[model samples]
Structures are given as structure tokens and as C-alpha cells.
Target chain A: MAMSVDLPALEQTAAPRAAAAARWSRYARPVLGLVLPVALALGWELVVALGYSNGRLVPPPSKVFETIVALAKSGELSRHILATLWRVGAGFALGVVAGTIMGAISGYWDFAKRLLDPTVQALRAIPSLAWVPLFVLWLGIFETSKVALIAVGVFFPIYLGVMGAILAVDRKIVEVGRVFRLSGPAMIRRILLPAVLPAYVVSLRVGLGLGWMFVVAAELIGASEGLGYLLLDGQQLGKPAQILAAIVIFAILGKLTDWLIEVAAAPLLRWQDAFGARGGQ
Target chain B: MLALKEVGKTYPNGVHALERFSAEISPGEIVAIIGGSGCGKSTLLRAIAGLDRASTGSVTLDNAPITSPHAEIGIIFQEPRLLPWLSVADNIGFGLADLPAEVRRERIAAALARVGLADKAVAWPRELSGGQAQRVAIARALVPQPEVLLLDEPFSALDAFTRRDLQDHLLDLWADTRPTLILVTHDVDEAVVLADRVLVMRPRPGRLFEEITINLARPRDRKSELFDTFKRRVLTALDRSLDRSVRDVTDKSSAGEAMWW
Candidate 1:
């Protein structure tokens, strides 16, 4: 179809202020979504004020908030957050690059599928914690074992997601590639890679969650210092306050990292469909 | 400029698609091929386009025997076949990647402008209507400056008005490109509308049943008495061929048997 105008034209056609207004309007819903949590916090404060559970089984959100602040002040929060971040940083980088390339190979070549798919699937069946024992045995109870554990956890889902994305490239588009007489390498670069972006971005998001979970499990086994190490130390010392602080940090950090992935993915995804008839592919 | 000699085909399950078929196409001629289902019209086009090998026979272009897909010979299937990932401009520029980048860009621009989608260069394929996508397909074919363009029932999916618009646009492209154009379709009215020569085909070993040189003028007025007369004649011939299947009229090579052999 011959569309005389493009997205830029559409943007221009909309009232100039419409674009800015639309961008901010999307945020309204998310801000509203936090209302329930705010209400829960108020309820928890009242319950703790009423002397619920003698303040032993459940700590008030207020107390947890104070502990969180204290932990941040003492650099405990930043140290563990950074420590977890670095392990994931190393493992996630390796997993993404390796998985993406292998996934593409599996997508395009039947031979690669025969060679790689079964091995990855079999390896993924082993839980991250299950590998903890063997990893410590092999690499000792140091940073190496924890990073290895995190990498293993991050790799499988991403590989599967990437491979699925490659396989899901619409057959109709492949026909276009065929007609163009696109050579093998050119087809992958121009067609397959871009088509797989949606699936790959989602996989990257999954990688963050998987990596966080693995760190917790790995640290539970043994660790010098990390968020998981802090949580373990708190439980042993009977300091419910410190344990609450670490758990709270874990929850918040997971969310913030997930949001970061979305922020990074947003512009790139928009660009992919910039020229499409539809806004997103 | 292109010729098919004794092209025969049979499906794996033993259905005869074509038998001893032969047809010649000259430069700058627009030929419309029409046939019922299983008549091998598409298979013939595929064979000639070098997309598939024939069970028997040979195809030649510019007097050279054709074996593989020729860069100068293009085929447009029913769908527009644009890559979902690429923008309109990238898709139009697709096959020209081997050309210098600057030349490819210019050709993509020219092709898009020719199809009246210059502004949609960055638009994705999904945003296009069926007619627009087909226009992109046409633009894609022309971008490479192909010597021959083959179409397989391109407008059959479009609504009446959209189809009419495309027919005119196709005629415009034809006027400009002036390549050897061969279109395959099942619509008699469509054949009458777009082709210089209309060839009627029959099944049960598809062979040309009749060939009528449409001695009509450009943009042959569809509502004109002359068009109605020729349309009725072609429809009657088509009906008669379908009803009486005993006789066989084939598209033998214009050259005698041994010359092509």
C-alpha cells in the first residue's frame, strides 16, 4: 500500500502539544496503581500500633522503613546492592551474547538445533541451587561460584526465548526475503535479528529476575558479603529488624532493575516499528 | 525475450499439472495467463522464473538457457511479501543492497516516489492496506531494474475499487518500465483489462486452450461497447473450453519442434 505520509507526518498532524501530553498521560495510570500499596502501609501502621503479635512475628512497615534508612546510611545497602549488581553484570553479559548468537544459529540451521538444543535444555533442567553444591566444590565458596550460578540461571530462559523469537518470525516476511534473493548473512542481519527483538527484550527482562533469584540461593549456601549474605547473617543473629531490612531491599531492587530494563527497551522497540504500517511489530 | 519449450509437470501424487506446454514472450509485451485451478499457470510462471525446475522442458531468456533465478527476472506472488521488520524504504531498497549505498538509496527513493509512497519510506509493512502493500511489492520489483516481471494473481484479494486503482497504477508502471510483463489470473474481466494478449488455459494436463490478441487501445474503456464485446467473446470461449475437454490446443513454441529441441 502506498501511504503518502509517515509517522513524522502523523506526529506533525497531531496538535504539537498532543505528543507531549500523550507521553505524560501514560504515567498517570502507573502512579495511580501505587494507591493500594499506600493504603496497605497505613493499615500495617495501625495494626502494629495496636500491639499486633507483640511486635515479634510482624514488624510495622514504619519500623522496616526506618531500618531500611539505617542500612542505607551505614553503606550496608549500597554495598550489597552493588555486590549483587556486579555478579549479575558479569554473568548476564556472557549469557546474553552467547544465547543470542546460539539462538540465531538454532533458528536458521537445522544442524545447530540438533547439536545445541538438547544440551541447553538438559542443562537448564538442573536448578540454580542444585548447581550451588557442585559450583562450590569446583570453584570454591567465593565470587566465582556465585557468578557461575547466576549465569547458569540467566542463560536458559534467554536462550529459549531468543530461539522462540527466531522461530516465530512470520513466514510471510521470510517469503519477502526469498523474493529479494537475500543472501544468507544478509537475511539474518536485515530480517531475522530485527524480528527477534521483541522476544529478545522480554528475555532480557527475565534474565534480571533469574539472576536476582540465583544470587539469593547462592548466598544462602555461603558468601562473604551480599544482600543474601546480610539476610543469612540476620537470621542467625535473631535480628528480625535486620532481616526485614534486607528483604525489603531485595524486593525494591528487583522492581527497580526490572523498570530499568523497560526504560532501556522502550526507545529501541519504538525505532524497530518506526517505519511499519503498525506502530510496533 | 523468453520462451518455454515442452514444459511438463506432475505432482508427486501423480496429478498432471502441465504436458508438452510451450509459450514465447517478447520484450515489452504484456501477456495475461488465465486458467482454472490445477491448470499449471502458476507452475509455468514458477518454472520460467527459475523458482522451480520443470519435470521436463527448458526455459530460455535472451536466448540463454535459464537454470537459476536471474537477477533481472522478478516474480510477484499474490501477497505483497514485505518484511515485517523493515520500513517501506528498506524493503524497497532490499534487493539493491549489492549496489553502492548511495545508488541504492536513490533507487529506493525513485521507486517509492513512483508508487506514490515517498513519505512512507520509514513506514512498516503492517500499516499498509492490501493495495498499498502490493504497490510496495511492485516498487520492490522495479527497484532492481529487472528486465522481466511476472505477477501471480496480485489483485485478486483487493476490493473492486482498490483493484481498479491498482490496475491503473500497474498500467502506469508498465508504461514506464516497459519490461516483458506476464500476469497470471483466473478473472476473464481482469485479463481483458490489463493484457496485450490474453491466453486461456485448461486443466487435465494444462496447455493453452486459446490465445486472443486483444486488439484494443490503451486503458481500453471497460464500459465501452468494444470492451463488452471482447469480454463476452473471451468468456464464451473460456466456458466452451471448460465444457468440452476432449480437444487440446497447446502453446507450441513459435519455432518448429526441432528448432527448440
Candidate 2:
């Protein structure tokens, strides 16, 4: 993107100018990653320029931009983003707490792992969307049901990741704890907890993504206040602009939340640098 | 004093790993148990460490029958099992639950310092070289100042030089604090170099074969004349034990007082 800006021509014979030109030339393909997106966006504008697609199937960026403005004016965009964010944060938190406890059981105790694994696997087979009716049936058509739905959706993936991380911990380390004569709780806290954290964190990130997705899906079906519900209401009211506005908000919030987690996790992962396995740069 | 009184172990699969094996380990003795792959050397160590229960007999530390893992016993397995996440200091401090926070920190620092890893107190296990990781493992085991230390071939994964160095390190640790050390190894030289007495075992339906005392001097240099003689004796005992396994296809009762020492 930087290289795309054409510099004013300076000299034809100077060595510095020639060097700058060479660098600019070399950067053309390396900068192609950013250029491709711009090109596609441009090409999308051309489609709108030609009118080969309708606003329904492919709303022009300009129209979507306008929808964003209208939603911002109404304060609806921020509301939806805040609502979705809260649900994902809550759901992700619940899922992590449950997943860690259960994951440790699956990792360390053969008896508990054998007993719980079958039930967990069975529950995981049910998709989050498929559970809408069941959640509503169990908890009624309210925020509780939607939150539960999103939590249920996030729980399994994180649980899977946590269990895998715990399982992936070196058997030798566990044995080391034993040789150190560590008691059960001390071993878990000192040895197992840190050892499995990397995996557990990765699972949480994945769960956050899945949880956000489920939050949107759950809101779409029966929500009255969530971003997904806003989009659905816009659809019912025959307002594509509102729907487009809702989508843009969703995209921004998703990117923002994921980025925030990564930023937050960076400090925790600095131990990576002590090992020099990852500079975490 | 530690003793295995008529110790017998049969795996769930019906493999007779040990049979009526009995031995007394007087205080501060370094005893090596040598056997082929399936020979219950590890099982004997596990029983002593109280990691596993012997089916028909009891292990005793000064006449107290072993029931479960106790702080008085430490066992180093074949692998260096350092937790990847914990720093070297924390790993060395892993089992020191009763220590006050300040005391724990001091002990952890001392252990890491002893292992020459004071500079790497905050380094993760993954940051360490193989030998360094194993040394930390040894440090973790030694930190507890256990009454008995069971080492199940704790240096087999290293190159010969590293193994020899660790053997020296093990001897130094034992010498400094004379914990009842029971080392299990398949390497004849390793057994001869480290042990005051080597117990040989036969494979498959494993039974103790013979007991040979190694009377070489301190740090028992492998290049020394005594080392070769001792290594030959352990190897011969191992070979004869393998032969005894073959002969056991016919004579099961012959594995008698050979184990009772």
C-alpha cells in the first residue's frame, strides 16, 4: 500500500534515485496482498457502475456506507455492537470456567474422563442453531435462553481445546511432579495449570469466535434487542439499509473483539520469550 | 533402612514382573537394579517409590510399610518430565507445599543454583537443551531431600558423555546427602559405575537373577581397570539371566535364593 503511492520523479542518473526506483519496483508484488483487496473493492464498484447486480443481491458500498451512517445517527449501531459484545463476553466467560474444570478431569483422571467423555461427545453433536427450540423450551423465550444457547455453542469447542491442551502436556512433566512428591492439588496448580494454558487460551479465542457467531444466530431467531435481532427486524420491516448497517457493525465488533483478546493475551504469553520459542512480536 | 519383604508383582495382563524378591537397602547405599526390557526393574522401583502396589508383598522404609506416595520418596523416570510452562525455579519448587513463601523461594533458588541454572531461573522447560532439562529434573527430585530416591534409568536418553556427567552428578548428590538411592538401568556399565550392589533380573515373567557387589572407589572412572571388571560381571550376570529366562521354559523353581539377599 505504501509503495502504491507514486513518488515525484527526481533524477534520471543519480544513484539514490535509481536505488529508490529499484526498491519501489521490488515492492510491487510484495505489496500485492493489500492491493488485491483494493482491486476487488474497485472491481465491486465497477459492478455497481455497470448495474449487472441489484441492490438486493449486491448492495453497493456507497449504499452500505450510507446505512452505516443512518444507524450511527440513530445510535443503533453502537447499541447492537455493545449488546453482542456483552453476550459473547459473558458466554465465553462461563464456557471457559466450565471447560477448564471439566478439561482437567478429562486430562488427569482416567475414571472421570471415561465417564464424562461420552456425554460431552454426544452433546457436541447437536449444533447451536439446532438447540434454539430446546433452549427456549427449557428456559423460555428470553435473554436467558439466548445466552444459554450461545454458551452451549461456545462450551464444546473450548472444552475440546482445553482437553487437548491438557492431554498434550508432556507426560514427562507430570511424572516430574510426582517425583517431586507433589500432592494432587499442588501438582494441578503448579504443573498442570501452566502447562495447559497455551492450549486453553487458544481454545478460549476459538470459543469467543464461535460464541459471537452463536449470539448472532440466537438473536436472529427470537431476540428483541441484539444486533442479529436488529437485522431480522430490518428484514421484516423491508429495510435492507438497516440490515446492511447491522452487518457492518457485526464485522467491526468481531474484528475488534478478536484483536482485543490477542492484545490482552500478549503479556501472558511473554513467557514465550523467556524460552525464546516465540518473541510474541 | 529400606526393605522389600517377599515382594511379588503380577500385572493385570498376568505378566509375572517380580516374584518373591526381597532385599534390604541399608541407609545411604546406592544400589542398582539391572535387567533386560521386560524385566521388572522399573516395577521394583515403582513399588519402592509407592507409585504402584506390589501384589503379594510389602515395601518398608525403616519397618513402615509403604502405602502411597509420600514426600520421603522421590522417583525419577526414564524421561526428564519438566513441565513446559513453569520456569526452572517454579519447577524446582513444585513439591515444596509446606515451605513458607520466603523459604520456598530460597529453597527453589538454592536448588536451581545447585544445578547451575540460577541464571535461567525464569526460562521455560522448552527453552532448555536436552541435558539441561534432565539436570533440572534431577534438581526437582533432589530438592525434596527425600529419604529414598528411585531413579529409573534417568540418563538413558542422553549421549554417552552427558550420561556419564549426569552419573557423576547423581553420585555427587548421593554423596552430599546419602539418600538411599535405588537406580534401575539396562546399561551394564551404568549399573557397575553407580551401584554398590547390582541386582540382575531375567525378562518375561521377570525374576531376579543374581546380586553382584561393585566395590570400585569414588567416582568409579569408566576408563579405570576396576570399571571394566565390574562392567563385565554385570553384563555376564545379565547374559546368564537371559539364559535363565530361556531355561525357565522348563525350570521355574530354580529362581530361588538368587534373589534373596
Candidate 3:
């Protein structure tokens, strides 16, 4: 009887502590991730300050930040950022539209799959950079060529993901669709779309990453005013600080865009019982 | 009434899964098809559901031929097969897309309550336990109130306790709509408990071996002597359906083991 009385009190005390710990951990997670990078940056800064070596080649984090600040103030940063953003946006839209259509066609029809899959697979095998020259020659060294290059890079993964996802849809679930006597469009809208969405989000992220990569390659070849152009300009001028700043900006932008996709997709995929849902917890 | 006349299924690989199977089932009658493995019990059920086309003969429900899936037919498989993206409420409402929103909502609420999952409306399919998921599936199938509900060993994947519970729950729900039920299973106990008539089939180009009418009234006691008798008869029929030489070898081996013991 005494133990039972104590149990309620124990539970009452433990619940608040558990809630506090959960609240603390939520804030601590992102802070914990920042630890190593912050430590490394501070260590390097101290090393340079102590006159151990001249930080000419690598430069400290402060110098990179100063360069970024200077660029941002000059309005050049916004121009470059906008140019890169536009290219990626345009390329991604084109790639996604083409990929989804082709993927659906091949996935839905065996005859189309038999006719088209081999060619797409073979095209996918070709290194994306190899197409750079051909794209440049055909479309010229304008935004068209750059966007086309990025689109090519983005297309393969999205196509493969959509097609594979469609193919991988459980036959049993499709049978459920059939049992309802769903019309063709109703089946696609209700069943096929939701079934492929998780993989579609993953492929979109992958395609976006490739779009970033190919944008750099596209800007490296020719043209002006992008983050890639910044890299080339910094390289030619031997401005290591500028180059590092461009690299930092690239990392931040890439992560931000990917997070955007993840955030947008989270509500849609709330029903997923995947391992990743638990994450590190 | 649902009628099957000389229904046969031959696979492209030259395997005859079902051969000249025929039956006429009246509305609201619960029929169980039972056999050993590879007996095409599922094939026959699938054909009736219109998921698969019979290579020969025809299946007609209420004088209309069933070449493809009909709106009047609903099916439950061994697995729940719930769409992972939809909530329990939405999954139940899946077949009722053609209905008005208010009607759909009321019906879904009703179905949810019937299945005893009123609290799990917003829950995901993955969040539910196996039994709960199957219950949701039953609710989904019954929401549209299909004229014929085909079950392909729906309870076989569940544990004995859960299976028995679901079997009872299924009957309770069946009483509501009185839809013609055609169930396929290997479990004699299940067949005895739920089926009004048990049709036993022979393997290797599966054909009807025997039809046993279960005359027992509703709320049938599982442990009753009559239940055991029905079970024994079905088991004996199943044993006979197998090859005689194989049965002899197994019997002799079992007898040898018995002697050793």
C-alpha cells in the first residue's frame, strides 16, 4: 500500500523531468552537429593568429567571411545568386516534366518499356560531362546550353526513380485498385501517384544535387555571373578567400534547397513507416 | 445469384490451375472453398473477383457476365493491402469516391464504428496492428456494400486467436449486409465456423472433390461435438484429395514413428 502510494508521486516527478529532457534534446541536436565545424574553424583561426604559419594558401574562416560580406555589399552576390537560381529552377522543371512523362509511359505500358528502356539506359550510362560540348555546339554558349546540360544531369535519376517506383508498386495494392473498378485516370491519380511520391521526392533531391553540379560545369566552360563564375574568377585572380567563400555559399545553398524539398515532402509522407522516420532517436 | 459454368484457367506456361469448376451461389450464402496447396483455390476466387479471366466458360453474377472487375464485387486478401499513404478513414473511404462528401463522411464514420476503429480515423495504416489493419480492410470492403465479397484466405496470415476473433467479427459484419461471401482457405476450423457450405477441391488441375453442407445455426460453438465432426469430415476429404501412394507413404511413416514412440 505504501509502495503504490509512492508510485504515483514517482510518476508525477518523472514525467516533468522527461519532458524537460525531450525539450533540451530538441534544441541540442542541431547545436551538437555544429560542434565539430565550429571547433575546427576556431582552431585554424588561433593557429593563424599565433604566427605558426602564414595562412596565405588556405586563409582562416574570418577572411572567407570578410570576402563574402564584401561581395554581398557590392550587389554582385545577388546577381550571381539569382542567375544560378534561375538556371537550376528552369532546368529542374524541364527535367521533371520530361522524366515523369517518359517514366509513366514506360512504366504503364510493356510495349513502350520494351521499345524505350534500353535507349534510356544506354543514354544514362554516358557521362553527363561528355554531353557538355555537344550541348554547347548545338545550343550555343548561352543560357540554353547551360540549362540543357543541367536538365540532362537531372533527367536520368528522376526518370529511373519514377520508372522503378512505378514498377515496384505492390501488385496486391494494384489489385485493390482493380477490385474497386477504378477508371484508368482514377487509378493513376489515387493509387499510382501516392505510391511513387516517396521515391519521387528522393529523386527530385538527387536531381537537384546534380543540377547544382552541372551548373558549375556549365559556368566553368563559358559565360559570366553565377557562383560557378565566382569560382572561376577567384581561381584566375588567385583569390583563395573568394574561392572558399563561393564554396561555402554553394554548400549552404545546396543544403537549404534540399531541406526545402524535405520540409515540403514531410506532410505528404507523414504516413510512411520507414526507418528514417525515427531518425537518430 | 452468382453462377460459374465450366470455368477453367490455363496459364501461358502450360499449367492448368483450375479445370472445369462450376457452382451456383445464391445471394447472401457464405461458401468456403478448401483444398491442399497448389489446388487453385485462389485462382478460382480471383476469377470470380474478375481479377483474372477464365480461359474457358463463364462467371455471371445476376445474369451479367464478369470479364473484368465489377463494382458489385469486393475482395479481401490474406494481407490487408492498405495504401500506406492514406489515413484509416481515407482508406475506408477509398471505394466510396463516387459518393458525395457528406455521405462519404457519414458512411466512413459508420464503417469505422462498425469495425471498432472509430478512434483510429486519423491514424496511418502503418500505425495499426495486423488485426486492426485487417479490420480496417474489412470495413473498406463492406463500406461500398458490394453484392459479393470474395475473401482469399483473409485470416490465414493471422495468429489462431486473432484469426478466430476476425472470423467472428467477419460474421457479425456479414449479418449486416448479407452479401454473398465466397471464401478460400486451407483451415478446416475456419471453413466449419464461417461457411454455410464447404467445397473441397482436389489438386493437380484443381477440380471440385466434395461439397459438404454445414447445417449448424449461427453463434456456433467451436468446441461442440458437431463442430469436431464437421472438422473431421473435411480433414478426411482433404486427405483423400491427395495422391493415394503419397498418403500411404506418409501414413506408414507416421505409423513407424508411432511404433518407435
Candidate 4:
């Protein structure tokens, strides 16, 4: 009787403990990813503190942090971050709109595909940076040229992704739309849109990455108020720590934006049956 | 009533998929189109569903020419073909978009219950098994109460036990509204189990070869001798349609029975 009572009591207590463990593990998994970077930073800091060298040319993480803090105190960090963010946002929006329209046309209509695809493919083959000179000449070296340059960088990937996704949509699923006698707009809304969304999200992520890349190039070409400008200024003034600080800021911003996109799309894509969604088993 | 008058299809590259095939099916009747590969069985079903045009003939439903997909007809393909983004309930309610939200919800609930998937209403298609997904597909097609339902080997991808279970489930659902069902299949047992009439077609310019009427009553027993007899007859017709020799037919028939049973 005593053993039975103790066994039931032990079981009761273990249940909530197991539940708490699971909950903790869920939060702990993401934190595990930060361990490597934190370890590397600490290791480098220890080396510098022990007088491994003067820590010049390739400054320690502490020096980079100090540079970042100084920029923040001067309000230069916010100005640069905002400038870069605005250019990317405007360019991404413009590129998405233009790419979506053109892709829809090319994918949905055979006539448009036959007429336009070859030319577009040929144009895509041209190195994107090769258009920098022409864009600067046409729009002048102001925000307009920078945004346009970023937009061009963002366009080709989105266009390819959308078109390929639309073309690859299962014909059998489209037949379901036809069987229901859905109107043209209804077919697009109900069927085409949802079907292409997964690929579209991937393309958006790729396009955003390119937007960041082109923004750096755009800012390098005679811009005064952006992270890329900070990079150029640091290089010319021989402030390697500031350059590292700017580079570090870029990495953080890029990762944060990409995570935002992923989090935003997670709910929409909860229905996906892909291998990645299953957490690789 | 649905009628096909000398329906034919010839591809642009000069291959004749179907040639002057014709049939008339009254409402509430279950008709099966069975043939060997390339016999245009699926092509006929597609034409009837108005997914593809009959190049040289006409398809009429209730005397209205069906040049494109019609509101009265719905189709279930070989695969479930459920929209991966939609929940089971949402997929069932997809065709009912024009109905008021209350009515749509009621119908979807009723459909989910009917397909024995009431608990899976919130589940995604990917989360369901093959048979469950196909059941959802059936619910999606039937929820709108289409007058004619076209099934293109809807259960071929399933295991035998699941296939039989779904076939019975389908028949039970059919007894509700008694919509006209035109099925395309390669399975002799399946053809006999569900269809009131079986139309066999020959390939190499597919055309109707024979029509075999199944006189067996409903709640069919798969192991019954009469069912075996009908299965044998359909199998023989299939062999003939494929132009197999008589010796090859006997040899293959026994092998098929061994596999199917």
C-alpha cells in the first residue's frame, strides 16, 4: 500500500517536470546557435588582453564595439542605418511590383513568353554592376540612381522565381479550378496566388539579399549618408576599427531583416509539407 | 442527362487520342470507362468534364452544350489534388465560395462528417494519409452537390484495403444525392464493384469496343462468385481491347486474380 501510494505521487510530480523541460528545450534550441560566435569573441578578447599583439590593422572585438558606440553617441549610426534601410525598402517595393506584373504576364500568356522571355534572359546574363554607369548617367548620382540600381539588382531574381513558380504549378490543381467554373480573377486569387506563394517568399528573401548588396555598391559611388559611406570613409581614413564596426552592423541588420521575413511568413506557410518544415526529421 | 455524340480528339501532332466515341448516360447512373493504357479513357473523362474540348463532336448536359467546365459537373483526379494551403474544412468549402458564410460552414461540417473526417477539419492536406487526403478530395468535390461527378481512377494510388473502404464510402455518399458518376479506371474489380455499366475502349485511335452491364445489386461482396464472373468478363474484354492472344489472356487473368485478391 505504501509503495503504490509513493509510485502514484512520484508519477504526478514527474509529469509537470517533464512538461517544463520540453518548454525550456524549445527556447534553448535557438540560444544554442549563439554559442559559437560568443565563444569566438571571448577567445579573441582574451588573446588581446593578454598582450598577444598591439591589436592594430585587425582590431579586437572590443575595439570594434567601442567604434560602434562612438558612432551611436554622435547619432551617425542612426542616420546611416536609416538611409540604407530607406533605399532598400523603396527599391524592394518597386522591384517586387514590376517583377510580379512582368512575371505574371510572361507565365500566364504564351504569346508574351515567346516574345519577351528570350530578351529578358539575354538581359539577365549581363553583369548587374555593368548597368551602374548607365543608371548613374540617366538618373544622376543622387538617391534616385541608388534606388534604381538597387531595384535592378532586386528585379531579376524575383522575376525568375515568380515565372518559374507559376509555370511549375501542378496542371491538375488548375483543373480543379476549371472544374469549379471559377472566373478568371477568381482562378488567380484562389488558385494561382496560393500556389505560387512559397516560391514567391523564397524569391523575396533572395531579392532582399541582392537589395543589400546593390545598396553597398550604390552608396560607395559618391554617397555621404549610409553605412557604405562609413565603410569608404573608414578605409580612406585608415580607421580599420570603424570599418569593422560598419561591417558588423551590416551583418546584424541583414540577419535581423531576414529573420523578420521568415517569422512573418511562418504562419502563412504552416501548411507546407516540405522536408525543412518537418525539421529534417 | 449527359450525352456524348461522336466525341473525338486528335492532337496537333497527328496522333488520334479518341475517335468518334459516343454514349448517353442518364442521371443517377454510375458509369465506368475501362481500357488498356493509351485507350483514351482519361481523355473521354476530361472531355465530359469540359476540361478539354472534343475536337469533332459534342458534349451536352441537360441539352446545354458543354464547351467549357460547367457548374453542374465536378471532378476528382487520380491524386487528391487538395490545395496544400487550405485546411480540410476550407478545401471542402472551396467551391461554396459564393454561398453565405453560415450556409457554407454548415455544408462543410456536414461534408466533413460524411467523409468521416469531422476531427480533421483543421488539419492540413499534408498532415493526412493518402486515403484520408483522397476522402477530403471526395468531400470537396461532392460538397457543392454537382449533378455529375467525374472520377479519374480516384482510388488507384491507395492500398487495396483503403481503396475498398473508400469505394464503399463513396457508394454510401452517392446514395445521398445520387449524382451521375462517370469513372475512368484500369481495375476490373473496381469497375465491377461500383459501375452500373462498363464501357471498354480499344486503343491505337481509341474507340468504344464493348459495353458490359453489371446486374449485381448494391452492398457488393468482393468475394462473391458473381462478382468474380463479372470481373472475368471485364478482364476478357480488356484483353480483347488490348489485342492480346487468347493464351496470354488466360495466363494473365489468373495472375491478375492472384494479385488483386
TM-score of chain A of each: 0.84, 0.79, 0.93, 0.90
Clashes of 3: 0
Clashing pairs in 4: none
Give the lDDT of residue B175 in candidate 1. Answer: 90
Q: Across residues B1-261, which tens digit of lDDT does each residue of candidate 1 receive?
A: 888899888878898888877778899899999878878899888888777778898889988887667888888889888877678898888788889988888888889899999878887787788888999999988878788999999899999999889988999998986988999998888888898888888877787887777778897799987787667767865776686655765433221222245
Q: How close is candidate 4 to the true structure, as a TM-score?
A: 0.91
Q: Of 2 and 4, which scores higher on lDDT?
A: 4
Worst 10 residues of 3 chain B by lDDT: B248-257
Which tens-of-lDDT digit does each residue in A162-277 have in candidate 4?
Answer: 99999999898898898888899999999999999999999999999999999999999989999999999999999999899989999998889888988999888888877654
* TM-score of the first chain in candidate 3 relative to the native first chain: 0.93
Candidate 3: the clashing residue pairs are none
Candidate 1 residues lying further than 4 Å off, grouped into runs, are A1-24, A50-54, A126-128, A271-281, B10-16, B100-102, B240-244, B251-261
Per-candidate DockQ vs. reference: 0.36, 0.22, 0.48, 0.47
CA RMSD for every model?
A: 5.4, 8.0, 5.8, 6.0
> Per-residue lDDT tens digits of candidate 2, residues A1-281?
12223565553347587777667766774587679767876787788778877667567777878888877789877787777778877877888788777877787778888999999999898766888888889989887888888888788877788788888877766766665566788877877787777777778778888888888888887766878988899889887867877887777788788888878876666565345332121
Q: Which 10-residue span in candidate 1 chain A carries the lowest summed lDDT?
A: A272-281
What is candidate 4's lDDT per residue for B90-153, written digit by digit as tens?
A: 9999999999999999999999999999998998887788999999999999998999999999
TM-score of each: 0.86, 0.82, 0.93, 0.91
Best by TM-score: 3
Residue A190 CA displacement from its true place in model 2, Å: 2.6
DockQ score for model 3, please? 0.48
